[model samples]
Target: MDLKNLHVLQQLMDLSQDCFLVPGPVRMGQPCLNALSTPVMTARGPEFRDVMAHLNSGLRNAFNLAPSEPVRGVQSWSGDDDYKVVVVSGSGTAAMEMVIANRFRSNDLVLVPTNGKFGERVAEMCQRFCNVKHLKYEWGRAFDLYELERQLERGCYESLLICHNETSTGITQDAAAIAEMCARHNTSFILDGITSVGGMPVHPTEWKAEAVVVGAQKCTAGPSGIAAIAINSNFIERVHAIRDQGDSNPNYYLDLVAALKKGGDDQTPWTPAINLAMGWGAALDVLKNESNKVRWDRCETMANGVRNLFLDLGFELLADAEQRSSTVTSILYPEGIDDAWRARLKEEFNTQVIGAQDHLKGKMFRIGSMGETPISEMVEGCKRMIECFTQFGMELPKVDVESYFK
Candidate 1:
């Protein structure tokens, strides 16, 4: 209701501001957007094949397919020779559903640890295809590895599913340890790292996962409509086995075997989002310019800055300090703040953050710092949040957000 604050907020919204702080479908940058605007390529043609080859390789390298390669200069876009990536014409949910539908059968016992919403979704998706055992934990909390190992010791499961970054709660599981347990149990592992893979240093292949599914949005800095799944030789063998026995999943579009068949020639079984794929290649290129560690550090720096801003403003974070995601921060509103703050933020400053769902509603909001979001954008986001707070006539404690970030 402050006129002066409203004027400043309007200026903030118009100040060359274009960045996403709500996780997926982040800014694609000018170059990638330009690529998207260009003519669409034939999904299976020579020109498209060449570029897709590069995208595949860049994607594998970005996902840490192998040990850190020599700090090679930017030369070409060829992917890792040892890895194979499938580009699905759907969101991360599709890729995840594919992994579940293809890897386990109705009789196979599958274990899922659900501490957050994404993990729960994975569990729900698997219920139709496999016999699921829920290792449930409270939302906004980390999973218990001891219990996970005990579940593995039961040796009843043939597949294990986990979300590396549970976006809803901003919790990142210790995938390394989970992988070790899955390996020991001789279980097929599927890691849904939709929000974690590019924003953190994760070695999914080396982690012994059968598949690691990530999306073009979220940490990849591309638009939605495409998801990438990296499959290991072990998983590919299962696909071959299923195909040989004439056993097919009920869902044809989400069939991993069909995807793998086309991926052999760097193509997809169905028509892909060609322009989005092209843009995804550029996004992969941007991350491949430096070490994955460097990119992860960049995301973490912005995430920590956002976290510090929330903490300094007396807001409690949802996840534990050690297990919080580097890509998004789930923040509990400070005292005297309510859910209406979300509408106020958007209306006053064109600023947006995700509010929690179901039970967590009105308890917290999520701010993303992954993809193309750098420190400057996070600083700007913090400024806008402060302005939104002041516009609501709430007195905040003396906290110099920028100086704190500095």
Candidate 2:
């Protein structure tokens, strides 16, 4: 319980190095970086605890729920009574697993439309739990909604899975359009918004999404660990009806009904990541402020800044500007440079940038402006990157950092 011992602190500090940039050349201009320096307490803060206490009282007063709701910080349904939200361990993957395990029996037909790495992971996860009918697409190409509709009309699936933002390739699907089509077809819809939520406009309730899964790290500006799902009442009822027929729930940890019945109070079936949750709570408080719109617009503005920087530097983006994700920007590495040179840039520059997944690995590198990353850091990161390119024997344009950052 004493998490402050020197050895423990050292380990935590080491982990923080990997999780955050501290007074380094890459620090983001956000208060979150400061929060990381403090000792993480196990319990909630006084203000957060008071809010939970009031929510607990409200739940009890309205729903007649037991004290269990307080433990998990579950609040009463104030907006729409037709849906339930559940928090879980892993990131968005956990929420997605919960929906896949609970909604369908083993070998039940489902449509999985994959465009990138996360989309492929969704299909893989679905296959692990059910018989998935994968509708695969090229990594950077847009999915054909008409083809999706045609496949659905062929009567082969009971559910459809879509990833709103394919982080691997900077492609965002038309989720609202897909949700509308699924609604018309009476097919269950599950959307993976791991990198889309909070950074972009996503209203799960209004979009008629059966299940919307989100992670804390990407758009929420939170530490990784906590993942959440918003489930409509109809989906909950469907799970109940399936269980009533004596089918086994494929996954116990991801069982939404059992989690909700705990009144949102108990610890997860598995031990929870407490410190990460604390960080997430702090991040969410920042997100709920009225200036959240400005924060999102800042992401858009920063993304545009990055895109324009790359284009001005004579490097092409991997995806179209309109379809690219506001959170991460993928750029095709300039021609004539091989993978070995790309690896050298990171070794020399002391900057971390992600390369493409699978076949696109040698062709592209991705830079993210997610969380509290400052636009200045990105502008400088690009300059260092260009310097590295020049050092690697690649011909590069002369970038005036003074004018660039201005």
Highest lDDT: which candidate? Answer: 1
Candidate 2 off by > 4 Å: 1-78, 264-270, 338-347, 398-406
Full-model lDDT for every candidate: 0.78, 0.66
Q: How accurate is candidate 2 locally (lDDT)?
A: 0.66
Residue 278 of candidate 1: its Cα lDDT?
Answer: 80
- Candidate 2, residues 1-406, lDDT tens digits: the string is 1335434634532322222211111232244445445564434344434333333332222211122333334443222345555566787788788888888878588899988889999999888877988889888688888999898887778889988888888877888888888888888888888777666666676677777777767776766666667677788888888888867456677776676665344334454455554555556556555244665676677677777777888888877556877777788977776566556545444456777888988898877766566666666566666766775576766766545434
Global fold similarity of model 2 (TM-score): 0.79
Per-residue C-alpha lDDT of model 1 across residues 58-128, encoded as one tens digit per residue: 67766777522222222222244345677788999998888778876567788999888889999898888
lDDT of 1: 0.78
Give per-residue lDDT, candidate 1, residue 36.
83
Highest TM-score model number = 1
**Model 2 error, position 3 (Å):** 41
